[model samples]
Target: MRLPEVEDTVNGPFTMIWSLLLSLFASLTARSVVNGQTPAGLAPKAFLSLPLGTVKPAGWLYDQLVVQTNGLAGHEHDFYHYVSESDWIGGTSYYSSLEEAGSYWFNGMVPNGILLDDPTIQSQVQQFLDYVLDHQDSTGWLGPEVNTTKPRYLWGRYPFFFGAIQMVEANATLTDRVVTAFHKFVALANTMLHNGEGLEDWTRTRWEDFVIVLQWLYDFHPEGNEDLLIDTMKQLKYTGDPWEDVFNETYFPKTAVEDLRNPFPVLTWHGVNMAEGLKALPSTYRFTHNQSDIDAASKGWDLLFQYHGRPSGIYAADEYLAGLEAARGGSYLYQVIGDPKFADRVERITYNALPATLTGDMWSRQYLQQQNQIAAKNMTPNPFPEDGPYSNVFGLEPNYPCCTVNHPQGWPKFISNSFVTTPDQASLVQVYLGPYTVSTMLAATGNKVSVSVDTLYPFSDTLTTTIKATKAFTYYVRIPSWVTNGTISVNGGPSRPVSPTNGLHAVSVHAGTTEFTLDLPSEITIEERPHGSVAVHRGPLHYAFDISRSSRVLAQNAQQPLAVDLEFDATEAWQYAIDPSTLTFHTGTPAGGQLPSPIFDSGLPPFTISVAACPIDWAEGGNTFAAAPPTDPACTGAVTNITLSPFGSTKLRIGEFPTFKAT
Candidate 1:
């Protein structure tokens, strides 16, 4: 079938046609191979993700998720106009034709509600799910866009079903209904792609989202329609942007988008697109089983970080692929490839970059957070290529509504992916450390096992994991690559140094409740930055010089005053260069002898690092962003001791600092 001709400025007029033909030929071949015989080169995931609500947050992590529940994440639909009147929820108000704002909220809130078991959030989510499921078009299309003549974009459905899939996983009652609705939608989607109806710029660029959903259906509930699903996945891949080619050194932009030559590409340079595109090759590898796809995925990740990475683990992209902005995608990579570095990278992002973008209470967030950020107010002529002046401010929708609704998934999804089972379900792997508990039946032993991890990790170097099971099973714990001198002890036994294989330490556990203590000894490590500057790291947490700041409400919602936009200005001087030699770490007990409820609050961390710093003449970029630290910066004032806190704990902070000799 000849598909509609869509303009393809990036790859030229013939690219789409060629891709469609190639995909058609490939799908036919795959169907024949998959019909009676197993397709060759199908890659297997090292770890399989447990269903939603499998892992529940505990300790300080529980407090964090609770804060999110009470904050904007839970209440966005109550007041925020975008979500409150979203098209997906039977309202006309929406940010774009894609209707992403509501879907983003749904995607994040599903895991958030299910993980917390928060009835309030769960009810809110259920309403949307009911509307979408009940209101599905006779043609199998979802959402309010049911007009046949007008063009249909499948992009929004990707995120919408992302949440719906989770809801099905968490609530058994919704399984048949959700799955049935998806089957219809998939059937229609397969036809739409064949006719080239929804293959526009944004949808084309982010086709991986759709492919992921199709792959999920194929794996768990094909329902005798495996060929249709595989055909749709192939069509989505070929019709979508060629991400693997884009990430190559020849095509990938080495410098910032503004610095690149004229005729700047839209999707290629977009920050969010780059982030979503990072998983494209990996997603393709599952079906293609091509080794080059895997190689490209890893290489693309490295290239992105090497050129545009910030101290906080996220690379830059205010709107375009600018020098430094906050984003995340490592969890999917870790699950697919089982690369220890992917696990390490996701941990770093969760501990450092993710929280730094959010307010202490998770109510407000910045659209653009920088590693060297010292102010959270609007800035004119900022570094971002396409963002407005208010991009850096802490607000409901600072520069765009995307981040506001999208940021909620960061914490909840991280917690969901924290604990996963090996492919055979013989062993439960603690992929990352956090305050969480997992209860699952081991398929290998046919016994239920529950593991509870209690610790203030990334803040404290020690954690206690207790395993309870009816039968013996193997347990794998990830010892982060940063830990060089770590030890583990089982049930008061003599401590032994942790020996890791590919960043994981395995332990054999006997039935009926066993406990293990892991102590990861950490020290201040200085990583030199571009200039004669440094960023501090100890274990997973990144340390930053917390700048004193005062905030004022910029805008407030009349319906709910708590939903307000805030502008934070640094109250005290922020130009300080630290002496790495004098950095000292300190820890103490909280007043209640427990970690603070809102541990991410500024000045609330139980642990602190004191470093001697001298006032330096650090210039500001357009009266907002701090410029790169000068080479061998001279001290403007006497060196004084300053307290450094976890990067996530400070909204206004100097995470990257110039260094000087302490004389």
Candidate 2:
């Protein structure tokens, strides 16, 4: 029979009652384990640090949140307090509450380098986990009690979503011997199983949110129990939110509907879910081998690219469902979605929003988040002549408290999670700015391989990836949509056919393990975005020029352009080359052999980076494309030379380039 709906809501007294019925649902079985069949090219454990790089920040942040969940971390003064509950970071309270407690412990702790079976914090945590499991029915459903007492259906609480994340981490490795047991636990509550009804009352919604945990669950059960999953999705979509409106269909594929309400037409469903959905969809076709899913994901990328797209390469998702924009609505939705494209997106977004948010060590909140209906973005919190709009800077109290703590996780995690591996296939190495390695056992060939990529991207184009194979099998690399002409050489061998996808290139390696080189031709390409902006890029390194030979601060404060306008001034056109041939980095100062002329009397010196810069720099709050008051030391690197600053260090500079016209 269908369980009561309130089961998914707040964990009340019902939790204790249901906890007894679902124990078996959590015990999933384990797959075959190869005793010593370590694949051929698997790297020494020393190289293990490579894969750990991408996950460290995420793990660290989860750890910190855990500390805060338990009142262990946070600088007392920084601790967040709320009225709705005793304390909260916005509406979420990881303290005291069991569900958020479940979320905080598992989501933040499990992927955090701790083994599920580890004994350290297991006693107490296990009590809760085991308590929930013991009650799970054979149908795979396990929870406290249902709040069916109310009319509204339970969409889901934090723990359910966070639980999915923990599940993925467990199944990622073969050693997760306990995954099978967990599946059995899930089976009891699942509708497909005997006596199981489904997600209970919170039916017909929460497909993606549930997948947050399911992705992890699927990871543990490589050969998933499809019946339970499909059954869960079936009842949840009883009357799926109508995509009839262009809002849900043409826009982001449903970035969460609030209790069946589609209030705002503007889009803020970017980032987190965009990343998650992208991760959920397979490269070729994992689910049903269906092409429609692939096409929909692609379109979703486009829509996300349009509305939620931020000055940073990533898309924006306001607090929850706010439209994509700076100020009040910016949020961190794309963080866990696990899609490669989202990775690329956030990489770009960082260039813009991150710096803006961190004016100086946690001093920026450019994207505003508000719970109310009105638009109270960066503006002061004003209601009618009541609360003014526009927030100037960040202090102990910004318009919202949640985004403040959550923002720091973006950069460190992005750099860390840039790559991954599947049981059978692996992602192709796209851009390599330095040396890094990846390890995975491909299911197709039952071979284990370790790939080490060595190069400097966005700074230098040429990179080499060495493949160490335990057995002969294929691997792949991404050919970015940005590259028009580039050469790929295997072990210095002739460049061969690399299946080219229009958006991003994915090159597969049929021969076991070998080193490959990619030589790309440098040229100027106008970034294609709505904001009419033009940037010059040679290989991956974006080129920027300082119109000021005297200071990094522009002599002309002339308003910087909002977006790139390809129709830039011809006479004053910004161009560069391996000029003088010896110049390592391309940089240019004021045109007249020297800057700080009588022109300085003209006010802020006008300057702009070439089109070679990365695409994310054009939006506001991004790399100062135009010019800025020099507060950063790297801004001093803007001498009248052909050298460039590390994209990560150029603080206090203009980024957005406006269309220039000659008199």
Candidate lDDT (C-alpha), each: 0.78, 0.34
Query: Model 1: runs farther than 4 Å from truth?
Result: 1-42, 85-91, 94-98, 146-150, 261-265, 324-329
Best by lDDT: 1
Which ranges in model 2 have alpha carbons more than 4 Å from their true place?
A: 1-206, 212-226, 239-290, 316-347, 350-397, 401-417, 420-435, 492-513, 520-524, 527-654
Error of 1 at 218 (Å): 1.0
lDDT of 1 by residue, 414-492 (tens): 8899988888877788988978899888887697999899888877788999999999777888888889789988877
TM-score versus the correct structure, for each prediction: 0.92, 0.53
Give the backbone clash total of model 2: 138
Per-residue accuracy of model 2 over 21-69 as CA lDDT, tens digit each: 2222211100111343311211111001123323222222232233332
Give the Cα-based TM-score of candidate 2 against the true structure.
0.53
